[model samples]
Target chain A: MSGAFISFQDATKDYGSVRVVENLNLDIARGEFVSLLGPSGSGKTTLLMMLAGFESVSGGTITLDGKVINDLPTYKRDMGVVFQNYALFPHMTVARNVAFPLEMRGEAKAVTAAKVKKALDMVQLGQLADRLPGQLSGGQQQRVALARALVFEPRVVLMDEPLGALDKQLREQMQLDIRELHHRLGLTVIFVTHDQDEALTMSDRIAIFNHGKIQQCAAPREVYDHPANRFVAEFIGETNLLDCKVSENAGETFSVTLDDGSVVAAHGLPGLVAGDRALLSLRPERIEILPAETDATATGQNRLAGEILDTIYQGDHLRVVIETAVGQIIARTDRKAQEWPVRARVMLTFRAADGWVIAP
Target chain B: MMAMSLFKSVYATLIVGFLVAPLLVVLPLAFTSGAFLTYPIPSYSFRWFSELVENTVWSRAILNSLLIAGSTTVVATLLGTLAALGLRARNLVLSSQIRTLFLLPMVVPAVVLGVGMQALFVRFGINSTYLSVIVAHSVIAIPFVVISVSGALGGIDRRVERAAESLGARPHKVFFLVTLPLAMPGVASGAALAFATSLDEVVLTLFVAGPNQRTLARQMFSTLRENISPAIASAAFVIIVGTILVALLLLLMRRRSA
Candidate 1:
């Protein structure tokens, strides 16, 4: 990225003797919405806290707009942080809570009132300005928190699992709302969440974290369609990781032999060589199941003959488990397609480009 | 279940009677028309209550008690709130031990504390002054403030403070605007308790106060040693009613805030 807006250079964090984040190096271009997606204890939230100035960097520098601000106090960082619990002042009315930052900056009373009204209107909570936070619903309080964070117009906004407390429908609605705000206001945002769907739906790039390190960082489609490693493959969505040994390593493609002596062609990670052990990551949704007697074939497609072990009827799709020569492979097919009974023979086919090889 | 409930009701009545029996005996004496505190044939009147306000000695004692208790509330609340805030530090070594140290005056015998405070105040050449009395009273009153304020401070979500800081409020502003307002109910209740403690205090007052600084409780003690007057009963009546009123006010404040 040229002229990065915020960068963490070899940043490390330790709590007592336990290192939570180790030598993290990442940069965000201006107005980019990046998400740190990981499971619990993966240090995603820790990285966000460090950038918010709530936690200190144990080593290396975190520079913002070309200025190293490792030691700057949270109040001077000029960043808005929205906590999962909303963290609104319980005693203050919604209007007063939104007006607090302006008051702290010693803005004139009339100006503060006008700005507070504008913020409340933005969140569509202007009618509830006089209500205390305790009187509002969970979603309403979240909107108030969002309004307050944006009222200061900070250069960057950091949200730590902001939608973790909401129901599914409300959470999706908030995701779209936050994404729209990020675009309309041109706000630089760093969101931390464990939900891959949320990260994919909102962020320009998703940084997959595990065991205190980022495994991969890329655009949503790139990460999902071509995961960098097994962790990213399984964590982002459902996938079948097949054990394979490299039989041939061409420049752009490689042929691997599965455990049952079935040869499968797939894209390799450049480091693969012939006879090396590698895992093949195949998405369940990418495979198509055809009738046993059909002579349908396509270019660049890998095929395997198998019997239908089980068929699970999902609402929109059918999940068919096949006992193939490679292993037990699971494929998702459209629900409207022809149904295959258990014990019936079927052919599974997927493009070689869809299967990615990762080092074992 | 019926038998258990009957037993519980009887046990409660016994406890209530045991506590109120003494007040009932002493309060009716405040309405006695007779000069001496005794039973039977004494017509009811407000004569002693009138004498409480009219007599200069009793009036001055009331004034002194109010002045000392008021000042003690201010000093105790300030010091106690600060101590509670300091103890809120994470990973504080021997935290419970430090809290125990703050509460030592609550359990230590009042006579022992009075003796030590008298010697300390005399060494500082401030004995027998209103400042000495207020300071001595605050020593015992501070523990209540600490207990209440620390409990309130504990209930707060620390992230709320961080949110304020992230919004560009400095540490001091975060405390004053966010923390202090939220913990105000505790501070208020603590102040009321401190005032009550000072008003009821006698042993400590006797050790540190002079004739000019005589308080109502101290005057009641001295008057008991000299002679039993209806004025003493009236003073006790005033104190019991005042304490209950203060307690009610504290409860009402907590309810409204909650």
Candidate 2:
């Protein structure tokens, strides 16, 4: 976000008349871990392919180190890319797979072997160097792919859903390993994934993409704390969106009136105006539900009176959905409240700051 | 269902026997001491095999067959592999039609192809040269190479090539270092098939090749009218054994590659 390393200047991609990626502009800083997070068909993978020189840029320029690379072939790009399927060569052993890039670069034989060994050791796959790619497990294959991509010490590494084929536990472990690698090596990584948790955990900044455009790009905490719009808020995590109309817009404070005539203060976007229809997005875990006897409905706090619709057990937390006069509001609380059940009367309470105002 | 399965088993066994019976009968007959292809062997002897090596005409015919078949294997493999690679292009115009045209030699009757090639080679004044027979056999062998190589190419995962390019390999290097190695099994099998097709070809050579360049198959066909020699049986034995060896080599290659 501060210093640009890899920048897309109005980059676009199209297939015939269908535009897969619109005019996109983003700056990836040096030594930063940036992720393109989106659903399938959102053009995130297309953008990565364009950067890797596999797809031609339809309308704009892509630059690395201040040099335009529009017509450069993939081999001349000098950037490493790990595919979603791992794509390990079935005919080659792990060591040869790692050495392929170095050999292509015409490195000395001794240097290539040493660097390959170091890279494999970095990924803890040193023992499997002599094994062919087909003989290794899925996780090991993924590690070999990583080793090959990193063996040449390229300036930037692009990974396209590299952990998508692994199981849940293995995926998370690989995510942490990648994050640690990024931290230790300080190499810029542009990761593309559909999983939100992966982006939140492994990225310094994440660009939330939808409809071939970026809705927001910021740090994980910044995106989680203040999403740019409804798409950003909903795509990043679970949230309860309530319809409301802006009632007051004073300095540093904006208030919105709920559909049921309940008014609450919210921190709206900078462009919000009085009397505009908007949504109050509140994270489920941010809202607290209490029994009818609690005396917590006070000023500076948004309050709602509703009956519990149903209670769901989520292993460590109890998710209670309340049917209020306006709409349903969900609250996730500690599982110790086992007594909360169906059709129980409850009071929903949240701070004014927890409700983020977003225009439709 | 049980009775139907039993019937299917018997039917399949009978078909296999029908196909394999002639091939087996030729081998034992080739070893017979008699001068004809009669049923029971009077005594097993190497007289025909000895005569096969000493006879000048038969030895020359064997050399011609080996030379033509070797050349045919080389020419067909290169051209057919190139055709298969070209067909992988997505933008090739009327590619399906082109693929069928490439395989037309396999569908057309051998006699028709032979007559057509005979006329064309005569018009070009290449009818009597060794080139005519080699090219004619190549026409028939190319389809097998194309079919086999294309099968191998199709089985390969295209993402592996993309991976190689991403690893900084140029297009040609990607083909040599990744694609060709993965498709070697198909290419080798195709070569074996082309060689076998060339060895067994008769009508095409008979129509195109002259008397001096007479191939083993053509000479063997003439032996029926000129003389009933068991040397033909010896040549048949040699061809059968050679083909089986090549097939076994192909199987071993596929297993090793896999």
Q: Please write out the lDDT profile of model 1 over residues B24-139, one tens digit for every residue.
A: 88888989999898887269999888988999999999999999999999999999999998898897999999999999999999999999999999999999999999999999
Itemize residue pairs with steric clashes in candidate 2: none
For candidate 2, the TM-score of chain A alone relative to the native chain A:
0.97
* Model 2 interface root-mean-square deviation: 0.8
- In the range B76-176, model 2's lDDT, one tens digit per residue, is 99999999999987679999999999999998999999999999999999997999999999999999999999999998888789889988999999999
Q: Model 1: residues >4 Å from true position, as ranges?
A: A296-300, B1-14
Q: Report the error of model 2 at residue B102, Å.
A: 1.5
lDDT of model 2 at position A148? 94
Question: Against the true structure, what is each candidate's TM-score?
Answer: 0.95, 0.96
Write the residue-wise lDDT of candidate 1 on A114-139 in tens digits.
99999999889999999999999999
- Per-residue lDDT tens digits of candidate 2, residues A181-266? 99999989999999999999999999999988888999999899789999999998899999999998885568999999989887
Query: What is the model-wide C-alpha lDDT for candidate 2?
Result: 0.90
TM-score of chain B of each: 0.96, 0.95
Q: What share of the true interface contacts does candidate 2 keep?
A: 0.76
